[model samples]
Target: MDINQTTESYLLNAIQNKRLSHTYMFEGDTLETLRRYGMFFALNIFGDTPRNQSLLVEGNHPDFYYLHTDENSIKKEAVGELMHVMNNKPTESEYKVYIIEAFDKLTPQAENSLLKFLEEPPEKTIAILLTIDKSNILPTIHSRAQHVHIKGQSSDRLKELEYLSEADLQTLDVLSLNAQHIKDTGENFTKLRSAAAEFSSKWINGHSLVLLDIKPMLDLCAERRDYSLLLQLIDGYVRQALHSKLKLDIFEPFKEGVKVDNIIGVNHLTNMLDEIEQANKMIQFNVHPMLAFEGMVIISKG
Candidate 1:
């Protein structure tokens, strides 16, 4: 189940026939993928051309607005600001488009505010909400927007997997066995994956002092504002370590530098994963990146 030709055709036809929905929900495995599709949809609405498409991709279009959770949940105030913006006429195009990333992270109050706007969207204004988990979105909002599920083929995924280092691929293999997927292949993500592997090896070897080793990585994550990917990488390593201890052959490559016996027990790993999730939630709510990373480090130490 991937974003095949059929999905692409349907969306294009909808735009050409002037049947595009006023509000849409794009659900997918990765934010980057969702964003790609969202930009496609937006460019089509504005009459797709090389220049306009490039502007949309670079986020330079005046009529296009992109929003995401800021340090925390999408607050009510942000929604209010969006509503105000939407109420105005399009600045340079026939339609104004708003794309919100991590829509499920919107606070309850923000959802209420959004619901009102969705109930009666301004004419020629389009709203695109992107989320990895559709179930977390409010039912009322769900009813108002058309849902689009974006899936990627394993074969295509493997192609992107080529960009990863041997070690990163091994970590990804472990995650795949557990039904987890990482679709990013950017250089920054590759570097983060390597850092995660090194950090996991040291942490499992009972070298709490290795905190110094990860400080630079933490700073990089903060600089890039990529807390989500950082957490995902850490989560992958923990899961891989757990599989290694269980003598899972699929995780063998990842076991090279890991001390199998020194790895935390399954129970502790489970708890640590839970704590990491909580830390991610805190970040969604807008906690400082350094604070969130420090908190996760402290949890791992314990």
Candidate 2:
């Protein structure tokens, strides 16, 4: 499904059946998407009105908690705040939801503080860690909570155009097969951080080359939100994937260090490819397309 369709349908399903998970990791590459889902969950699940939604913006959600990580790392006090919030009972709703946006940025000390809470979470508290990457999360926290791997919305029109550029008449395809991989590696922004360090010289040397073709993907990378710095790297990598996997002739320095796995089926790849375009459009309207495309590229690399 496309980005608009996916969110619409998912929210519909959630509202229709109330199959809301207590803790969700709305893992995507865009900060906007992160906050968008945060709002969606708050408004729908807690029945907050437009006025209350404004309060959520001001970090005043009565039943909600926002967690942030500074450039240095997530502060130890953040965990303390969380513990305080969880210790108390729900104020307005059955679930006192916590939206831990960017929890993966937590410092080691910050992460450690929450081990006890994750193990035995408050009976009525639902903690959703909105993250681009969960690599930093402790195994203890990961194991205790139910893992909801919110994959990227399916590929959009840009992806469809990507596939159409190939010379061969349907000789091979990248979409439809990597659905699960897309979910697992949704918006592999974490990879870009390491890649930059690992390939700085190459990236710098190819700076001119990268700049020439980085604009389109960069445009789709969304605004310079919290995850802005890494968006360009991500955009470039997807360009590499589109050219490499789908056989498009995009010229850029290919990134290394990842073990490419090309075993996904056609169905998953097409769906993801289609969603990529929808996500791009959404990004044009201020939606975050980073993670959605990131997921597709990760899956395609496989």
CA lDDT scores, all candidates in order: 0.73, 0.52
Residue 147 lDDT, candidate 2, scale 0-100: 56
lDDT of 1 by residue, 139-250 (tens): 9889988999876343433555576676666655544321123442256666676777777666655565766765777665633336666777777777767776777756
* TM-score against native, each model: 0.54, 0.50
Residue-by-residue lDDT tens digits, candidate 2, 1-302: 12355665776576569676555666654444555666676666676567666777787767777776546467888789878977888787667778776777787887788776766777777777776666557877776665544543334212322322232111112221222222233344234334432332233223334323333444532334323333334344344444455655533433342222365334443444454455454554665445543443444333
Per-model clash counts, in order, read 7, 25
The candidate that achieves the highest lDDT relative to the unseen native structure: 1
Runs in model 2 with CA error above 4 Å?
Answer: 1-3, 146-302
What residue pairs clash in candidate 1, if any at all?
2-151, 71-285, 71-286, 72-284, 72-285, 72-286, 73-285
Model 1, residue 249: distance off in Å is: 17
